[model samples]
Target: MPPSPAQIRSLVTAYLDRHPGEHDALAPLTSALDSAGDPTSRTTLPGHVTCSVAVIDRGARVLHVLHRGTGLLLAPGGHVEAADETLLAAALREVEEEAGIPASALVLTADFRDGPIDIDVHDIDASPARAEAAHQHDDFRFVVHLADDAPDLTLQVEEVGGAAWLPFEEVSSPTLRAKLVASGLDGAIRPVKLEQHAAEHPAPAVRTEPAAVAPAGAPSGTVPNIVGVHLYLERDGHVLLGRRHPDAAYAGGSWHTLAGHLEAEAATAGLVREAYEEAGLVIDPADLELVHTVHMVERPGDDPRIGLFFRARRWEGVPEVREPDRCVGWRWWRAEDLPEPIVPYTRVAIEGIQAGRAYSELGWAR
Candidate 1:
């Protein structure tokens, strides 16, 4: 069954939360929902909702098809069908039908959850042969990651004249291109949680660049960066450090500060959780203060991240290795005489904090 009007409204509401500026532009869609006709129906005049899918490969290229009807290169999409359970299902179905790519070969990015990454409204030319008036299309654009080794394309020749993979910057939609470039996905569909990979194995330092972050004064619709929290606990002239387990995916066997990605929580709250989970230290939210922030790209061609470092003025309990697979041990090191083999960004952050600098950047092009 096609999604209900209520479901469609909910999807738009959620999308609007991420892009409040579009409320006026999307008035047609909101108005259509209140009309007597079904917005999902192609015959519904003036405008109707449609689903589109952006298929991204591991190299971060977007698969675009030469659409025959419009004589334009665009993401695979069309009218929603009764058999489609939701907009997402409709989008996946369109991709499979037009590109010959199976749904099994793709995965949705964790960032948007089940919602469309972008919603675009465009005008469609009237078709005299079909006796159809000119109308608008409310396109709900969903993004998917193609598997690294997916099969070659088999375009539905009748509709798609040809298909090609283009860099994100080359995508036709300025809004879609900006969102994709800001996301810095590099073909990786982010895992829901980093802790899931916390197992004892000699995995190479996770070949990651950095987390997501939306910088101050960023334009609306820019994808936010992956946020993380780092705990800065100090006693006397020494600071706390941990030895990540030798088998960890990231910075294995390296000394680093107690840190973690922010899960549906405030930065300070996330830091408090990491302190207790990784080191068994009890912290009061009142005792924490923002100290430093690192806007860094760990490597070239990766998404940038925003790291929040918080200083704890007072805390209870001794630090211990609570998650052995993530961190094997905890210790203190002097500011002037820190231990070797620390995570590079961790070292930069420590120096900045000591030097009383509130912000630092790494790996960004000059």
Candidate 2:
């Protein structure tokens, strides 16, 4: 008999659980299956998996072009390993290992691309005979956003020849000088010109005007803005709750749902990180869903706040209070029997749950 959806989901989940690091290895095959459906239509040969970096600055301009020793310039990226199950993971690992920066410090902007060439092969002599030739490589690229305050970098001497930053105006040059221009290095060479311009021009005054208002009839007020990949973490039909530590600055001695503030550096990634930190559980990214965004103005004396909520049912570890100071304890509670002295936003979120409303937009009257 053909497998039911539940059975198929279970089988796929089980397989994924067993090979946690095989997600990237399986992506091409998954894409092929998505497009062609028939397994026989896909290429069966193994290809060398590799990654490239496109590091953009805080102003969204391309920074230094990481180059190989032979003078070929490209972003920082490389081949995947047996331990890397996904292209993103490989890209992050390569960036940190080769660039000497932490994955948390950089933001991934684009998904891995097959790039300009769909197939790249590197042939090597396997033996003295021509028939014994071997081939390696399939190139991929990912865009990365560097922190605004990133420091001057040191090249990984063995893997990289050197790096140079290029300027926007010089990028159009026809000769190799243009490569230097395009890469933004020429700007570094001529700081006096920029200084001269700065000296000649006066700085603009700061604007204190209120932001442009929305047109009449536009939907105004707070809007729900849920993010992706945080969990609801239900067990035995009861959802979990955590009590804030008495010393917590924001919501001391209050009951609240397991949640955390998303990091500015990595918004999407922060959801997964928060789940792990707050609940002491590891969840698959694919298993989480964005449930709602709750926007609200503070009551007379309370602080104004906005919140994004998410829900997930699957995880690998049991829940616990990881930060004893930030979270004193945790318990499972039914939707009907919520604890008292809850944080205001926490109460709003739980009310969203009980009302079967996915989100709420709240506003404060001045």
Candidate 3:
């Protein structure tokens, strides 16, 4: 049975207090609760949440449906509808609708009392064909299995192009990889680890000379530029910092302030979004005060970027390593005394903040 509304809220609150590490990944759901003060509204956005279920067979082969729209193999699931009474029910319903599998054929495998096995938060880009803005999806993933007496399987013609029972070791989708790890079924046939930074992160060549020519295959007057939004969440004379999962694309194995690239959103909104996504904190734009801006470039032909640093004092939830795949851990460092191996741009911004300076630059000779 689904927990009552009050009980559900209590369960969420307990989960939040106990698993501080899950705050970032669980932010969208929590934020929905905070805004609407109800769990039902979480199924849509400003923050949207969905339920996904991984169905397994007796032979240990996992069930996968080829999504006709995205062309990627994924678990059987979809958006949570109004009629759904609980997240588990929603997961079952999606399995039926997307995979043509009946609820009687499945059994829940994970602890329903412990929220979801995993929650994925990502932006869904808008298409020119669709008159919609980019939005986010917060997926609550569950694991289920075929019943002992269940018969042979079939596929949903409209939603799924194909259905297969495959070994978990063969599932190449990163989305499925994270879910398998969380469910521990990946234990029997461990999935390939894709979070190794050494293979993805590149060490750049140091240079003492500036570029003498335009980038190859570039337009005569066109050059690229980038912008970053960083949070300087401070409280009790300390600021929040996160250690990039040694496998980050750039600056892996480095301590950096909570930051993200600018999207098609305002700087403050992006910061608010990132704070919730990276630290599981709801930062009010009104409470954010600009502290510093770092204009830096890594190499010639590299796009110039402006890092806008904002100090946030008022927010909800304590710091957490929300995106564990991207950041291994989070900490509070005294602004005056920071740890080493900091991202050079971030370190420069902090130094400027401490020195009462406003603007900074790097990777350029004075």
Candidate 4:
């Protein structure tokens, strides 16, 4: 079902939170929502809410289709329809209808979950043949990560004549282009590529630059085990986890607890810093209790690391995206029902903590 009037209002409010400067530009939309019978209805005068999808690959290329009606290269999009449940769903449906890329192959970026990356308001020419008067479209633009580097595309020849992937800089929408460049998502290497690199360079002695920097001349070929802190914030039988962005150096696009590597500070101090820095949560050291520890190695020949999980008895503020580069958003999951694609050790650590075990080991040879 199409979104209700209240839903439209909430979406506009969220979008404004991100781009406050665009409030004046969106007045028509707000006014429509205020006076409307149905702002999503095609018959609404002045303007209505429309949606577009931007398909970006791991390499940072965006998909554009030659729109048959206008003979212009554009992202897949159209007016909202009754079958759509949300603006984002409408955008995704349009992509599949016009570009033939199934929903299974696309993952919406974290930033797009709250609202569109861009909202473009523009005029549409009158169509005499269809007996439609001139109007405007408050086009909500969303971005999605394409899983495959090269996917077969079957265009709807009636609306889309051809399709091609273009570099991000060449994207037609100036707002979208600027945002994409600033986001640095184009530089993110997918997990599959990281695995391929590890396979090619075997890991006993060689480590990826991000995780392998040796301490100041300690030893010739020695890689030290890095120590990190994890926060286990539980409320009403649920624990918190954040979905790492695809661009993260480790476990990109996977679920993990709030965590960070310890610096020169004490472990508890480091946890407090990371809590505020990553999730906008303020935790007190006195309220923290040592819960569990995991000694883990990602692979057979890789250097090991120590993860110290600490449970916070109390904390201030709700979990939010303070570091977009590392995580998209934080969600609470039941102890028995966790989401998939979670970091392997993270799952183990959570289970151990629940079982009242203080320490566990993983990825070591028997």
Estimated TM-score for each candidate: 0.53, 0.37, 0.44, 0.53
Write down the worst ten-residue block by lDDT for model 1.
Answer: 196-205
Which candidate number has the best lDDT?
Answer: 1
Instruction: List the candidate 1 regions with Cα displacement exceeding 4 Å.
Output: 193-366
Model 3: lDDT equals 0.65
Positional deviation of residue 74's Cα in model 1 after best superposition, in angstroms: 0.7
Candidate 2 residues lying further than 4 Å off, grouped into runs, are: 1-231, 264-268, 299-304
lDDT, candidate 3, at 345: 84
In model 3, which regions exceed 4 Å deviation? 1-19, 37-43, 110-115, 127-130, 170-176, 182-366
What lDDT tens digits, residue by residue, belong to model 4 across residues 120-227?
888999999988899998888877777543258989999899998888889887887877777767634222111111101111111212223344555656565757
Candidate 1 residues 94-133, lDDT tens each?
Answer: 8888999877566556576457889999888999998989
| TM-score of model number 1 | 0.53
lDDT of each: 0.78, 0.47, 0.65, 0.76
**On residues 1-366, what C-alpha lDDT tens digit does candidate 2 reach at each position?**
111123223323444464466567555544443342322211223333355444555443443444554365545666555344234455556666656655544533322111111122233234334343344343443444565344556567777776654443332112222222333321111101001010011111101111122223447652223222224656676767887766454466787777654433343456677767667788666767666667666455322345666677577787787666467888888766778887666667766766778877666674
Instruction: Give the runs in model 4 whose Cα sits over 4 Å from its true position.
Output: 187-366
In model 4, the worst 10-residue window by lDDT is 195-204
Error of 1 at 307 (Å): 35
**In candidate 3, how many Å is residue 68 off?**
1.0
